[model samples]
Target: MPPAPQAYRPATALLDLGPTFWDPVEGANFPGTIVRYRNDRAAAEVGLADLDDAEWVRHFGRFAPLPDTLPQPLALRYHGHQFRSYNPDIGDGRGFTFAQLYDRAGRLMDLGTKGSGQTPYSRFGDGRLTLKGGVREILATEMLEALNVPTSRTLSLIETGEELVRGDEPSPTRSAVLVRLSHGHIRIGTFQRLAYEQDEDGMRALVGYVLRRLYGEESDDPIRLLDHVVRRTATLAARYMAAGFVHGVLNSDNINVTGESFDYGPWRFAPSWDPNFTAAYFDQTGLYAFGRQPEAIHWDVMQLAASLRLVAESEPLIETLQTFASHYQPAIADALLWRLGVVPRGAEPDRALVQTLERALRTTAAPLDRTFFDLFGGTVPASYDAAWDGLRAALADYRPRKPSDHPYWQGEPCAMLIDEVEAIWAPIADSDDWSRLHAKVDAIRQMGEALA
Candidate 1:
């Protein structure tokens, strides 16, 4: 028989960072709790898969303190630039870090809640998440992960039985609380807060805490930390391009220090490789469009470097910031190769493949996911024409990582296009039918396995 699952290992790394980083808060007294979605796969990683539905809801929905974890939720503090406009009065307005524990890999993971309740940062708005919004987050994380993007995994989503009014969606829509499993919650905005206050001591303390606890690096040098963050952030931006994903909001607060992507809002997957495609309807300026994501991410990294100037010299930070493009260009080729399930020949050939394929995608306007799916292992079918000639030549010598015999590769690629997302939500909104949603998750998993 297989070995039994290990017990939950509670951690206090965040608490050890001191009270300056967060404020203790209570979760909202939700009128009713209905388990909408629970990720058993993610729970197993954190040793919570053994819990029954009631037990799960008690901890996740009711926000009960875990056996040896946090005593109460902590609302983290930070400031971010929204659409390039600096906003000093924003933090975990509608969410709070609920608990900390070690995953099976011994890495620290946070259980952060969304739509749980309000905090000091709520401002004049209600701190609640619409049910549809929660569902979208789940779908976004799931699809992104399948495409090999390092993202926060949705742990649990529970309907809170509260009707919320919003200008974005239909008024008086159902509300829910969502819990995400993430590597860490420290954001670029976290450092910006201390920098804005001109608190040198706080800046040094925060940098030390991140290095020792999250990164496992012994040095407290902020320059080293900035370099690590820039590298990871570059790789993340490349993965987003490879996945054809548009994270509508790329605010500093939304970008985590760990380089893991989280906080999904108004996100969309591309139907075709259109550089001008924007996810948010309000993004009239196309500031965070699909093609501009790398630039946006680079800007966020620069802000991070700027914050580090409190503890480090401006020269090294500038040098570190300049390395983003160098890391990003190569990372894009690697990420695309992973998605295409091909073996790399060399840097020159791989980059040529990426460049040629991009040109073909832009000119042909072929379906983004489908094009990658069809060309898996560099196999170009006879249906190709002159538009694909450049891409075919570039990929001629490459070989597939594995055989494309998976049943999923035989049919239409599993995609989360906007229309498909709405189609999945329509049933839940109209008749509470969730079969389609569950089926999509299952299909997405199959695709992930095939890619793996």
Candidate 2:
């Protein structure tokens, strides 16, 4: 059955937190342009399904704050460690939190923008996003969500009729504005900034606000908060591995407090189970590679632990940090079972199964997505390939999520490889053709539904 239409319930909880956390700013005025894409599925969750192209342009492209929402947009302030070096001079330079609202599930959601406009934090640069960058983000979020990775959703993308020069891509690319729907915009860097300023009181208030809004826990203890973040971060790392995704940039600022992954810059999915695979062109040392993601996330969590020292005891925080491996290993096993679409056996047997699957993948170097499709949903094997013998034995004691006749199981696996994503955007880049992009999104949505 179709889900009931959701009603928009605007709120201003973040605004109520006061001015120290962010700076009030207005969105940039773009030349009158058209709405290029609207995520109606995501829109429905926030009661925005009926928005016309003009309305989308006004709200997203023109930076008009939603009525009855926050009175003004806020460019958040944060400090992050970029490539293991503490960079205290960073914040929301281009985008801001436009509004907040409750979704149909009663969870608080934030409507944040990217490439919205320049703010006080915009240091010596034009605040605009390339049209191609916007397109890539939409694809990244949609595909990640379909794979059941905890991620932010792309709400809207609008072309803003401006030419911007960039060093990474071709010069003078078209400009755009992107709106993202996320659980919250708070980041680990948010706390790090407070620590850097020696604002112990500010850190306490921010922690309280996060607990109330996100975790719904009544405890104000910093150790409790650290424990929660560690668990969530472990699960997030495992999910990325299970989905074969590389976030490219795992900086503290990019890691949200909610443990949901967002801000897709140079993201990619693994073509095969290569642990050293990297997505970003400029990651010279491969700091955020496929295999090192868990380590990177753990390091970021330790930074969070370090920041919390201003308000909490260091001993408790360090003890909590040590629990990461215990949380991460089990989470990875569970996520792998989820990807394989099988019910888990006993704990011992499940762990052994996970280990066997890992060893097989590493030995064969099989394409991760193809391997899932080959084994999941009760699809019969065409031959008794010796390479898959361990995997077949691993599945012997588990049941599939669907019958062998499920339609999605009958065809080739749907993969969002980087090459395919570029092909989807090539037509649009050349002649403004968006049919392929639209079709790809539809295919991804269908796969998500089938998995559910």
TM-score of each: 0.98, 0.97
In angstroms, give how far residue 135 of model 2 lies from its true place: 0.9
The lDDT of model 1 is 0.91
Question: CA shift at 172, candidate 2, in angstroms?
Answer: 1.9
Over 4 Å off, model 2: 378-384
Against the true structure, candidate 2 has what lDDT? 0.88
TM-score of predicted structure 1: 0.98
Worst 10 residues of 1 by lDDT: 1-10
How would you encode candidate 2's per-residue C-alpha lDDT over 1-452 as one tens digit per residue? 86877998998989757899999999888885768889998999988888888788878777677879998889999999998999999899989998898899887899999998899988987878888999999999998898888999999998888999999988788898999999999999999999999999999998888888888788778888899999999999999999999999999999998899999889999988888999999998999999999999999999999999999999999999999999998899888888888777767888998888888888889888888887774332766378778877777778875654656766778898989988987898899999998988888887787676
Question: Which pairs clash (backbone N, Cα, C closer than 3 Å) in model 2?
Answer: none
For model 2, state the Cα shift of residue 303 in Å. 0.7
Top model number, lDDT: 1
Residue 274 of candidate 1: its Cα lDDT?
Answer: 92
